[model samples]
Target: METWKEPQTIILWIIIVALFVIILLTSIIFLVRTIFKKIIKAKEKEAAIQLDYQKNLLETTIKTQEIERHRIAADIHDGLIGKLTALKMQQEITSKDQKTIDALHESITVARRISHDLSPPLVEFTKLPELIKELLDPWEQHLLITTIFDIRAEINDTEEFKVQITRLIQEIITNTIKHAEATQMYLHLKQTENYMALYISDNGKGYDVAKNSKGLGTKNIETRVQFLKGVYKVKSKIGKGTSNMFLFKN
Candidate 1:
């Protein structure tokens, strides 16, 4: 049978071509899979970046809200407190009861002074350090609190921000005396070329900052910072103390 016609050399060539085609297709599939994987990784990275940006934005918003609350607090302390104290004094004077005259006068003076201490428009007229000292003086005897202020450089001379800063300081000081159960506190004001920083630290029985669910004061502070486009942070250690920082851009 003529050695089976040598199995046809052309057929052998066709078989080789078919094998080559199969190999080529397999390589192309692998290449496509790799490209798809790379695309998926890129998308995942992009999503992560977006998530981080959103988180930062949310934090900033919360801080702004805190600032607003403090501003309102300051306003009430400044405007309403003084007006009410003045009225109280007037009422006492008109009572015509000489027996209580001395007591009434003393009480009215105390109230008026408290009002002034709580709400100082010193931002309109004086430097921040001086205003801070005047604000804390009244409470020193009551709390036995030690306050230390460290100023690295002259702070921003901007007038509009002074009132806001003073308000912030007052709030923190009140919180420390009323809640922190602390006997000592330290305040540091630092001035940089681009930022103004305030550090309020208290040595007291500290509490958890994260576990606060209904803390209006905390929320208020956070909001105000955000409103001013500042950085706000509260660091507290149980049984140790608490440190709060506010950094505003100049």
Candidate 2:
């Protein structure tokens, strides 16, 4: 009887040890999984915070840029415009050449237009389609290139949206005319179910866009798109020309 009791006691101790080991392993596994989940959540939170920071920074920068533009326009109108006017006034005395005087007059007119462009337009009071047409007028007589426009989207009343879209078009066309030397260009703006789409294409000398990825014009366009919470894609080839598409959510 004494030997039987000893063996039973040994069996009970073995069972107890096995149960303890199983509980310990389960706890360890649960602790490892919890820690992994916390790590993943932390990383996701950090990314969200960073994205918010970028959005806020972009908004402030755009507002500051508008203010600077206004100041520059005022300076040009007050100083450069005045000087150009004075030059035209002295045209007769400086030279009797009507051609020179006419040239000076044209310069003054161009300067005034530049100053006006530097200031924000009354987008709320104007037709966006008309404004865009006016913007394209300068390129109409570019004997080198034919410009086409297809506008099917009504203007968004939001001030920021209007200004950014208009400026985007202006800047892109300016880049194309000044750099691309393309023979043809098309500007298309359309509205879809969820957003407005802008498509610009030019047939000209495309560049190594990857090499000059951080170019001023490219950065400016990218920043503007980001400000509007939009996306843009640019495609270009050395001789095949370039096409850029932008989508702005409604």
Candidate 3:
């Protein structure tokens, strides 16, 4: 009976040890699962935050663009137009002699050219490539600028995208000459995979875009890209030059 009692005690101790091991393993597994859930929750929260930030940024950018467009329109209508009207009034008041009239007429022609250059009919009539070439003509000799025009000949046949693309190219080229200090620039237009890509790269002193103010230049490019339903990428680093790449899908 004592021997039987001793074996029973040993069996009970073995059972207790096995139960403790099982309990320890279960606790460890639960802890690991809880840690994994916490990690997942944190990642989800971060993603949500990033999405919200992007949405807000896009909204603010749209508002800023509208304001700028209004300002530019006002400048064209009220400012430049007013100046031209004043000039015409002066001409009317002056003598009607042939020499005087001829000089006035030439003056008027120059004024008209300036006005047209500032706010061109290309915005409504000409194709994008032609407009870009027209804008770059003055700077060509000064900057040693060379163009690789890959613009589709039939692109202007469609009214929808032509105007927007022209505006985008004008802004890009203007900025490249004024700010990039680039000696040579390249413009490439191509279509692939149901998308059109415009690549403009310049060899110049690059800028720190992240730290720089995202002013009218950057905003204008961004707005044009958005209006065209395109993706835009600007890449630049100090001493390495800059590239503005735009991809549009039809």
**How do the predictions measure up, each by TM-score?**
0.58, 0.81, 0.58
lDDT of 3 by residue, 1-250 (tens): 6764798888998899999999999999999999999999999999999977876776576557545654665575567656656665676677545665566566655555454454555465776667667766755765666667664434433444664566677687778778888887777777544667788888888899897648787887786677566899989988888888998875
Model 2 clashing residue pairs (backbone): none
State the lDDT at 26 in candidate 1: 92
List runs of model 2 lying over 4 Å from the truth. 1-18, 86-97, 143-155
Count clashing pairs, candidate 1: 13
Error of 1 at 85 (Å): 10
Q: Write one digit per residue (lDDT tens) for candidate 1, span 87-179.
A: 656767687555565665666566555556544555567877777777777778756655555656676565446655766777787788888
Q: Which stretches of candidate 1 lie over 4 Å from their true place?
A: 1-99
The lDDT ranking, best first, is 2, 1, 3
On lDDT, the leading prediction is 2
Residue 49, candidate 2: alpha-carbon lDDT? 100
Candidate 2 lDDT by residue in tens digits, 1-250: 6764798888998899999999999999999999999999999999999988988898999999988987998898899889877887788787777998898888887877776667645666766565667667766776243444454555455766777777788788778878888878877777644677778888888988889778888889999988888999999999988899998777
TM-score winner between candidates 2 and 3: 2
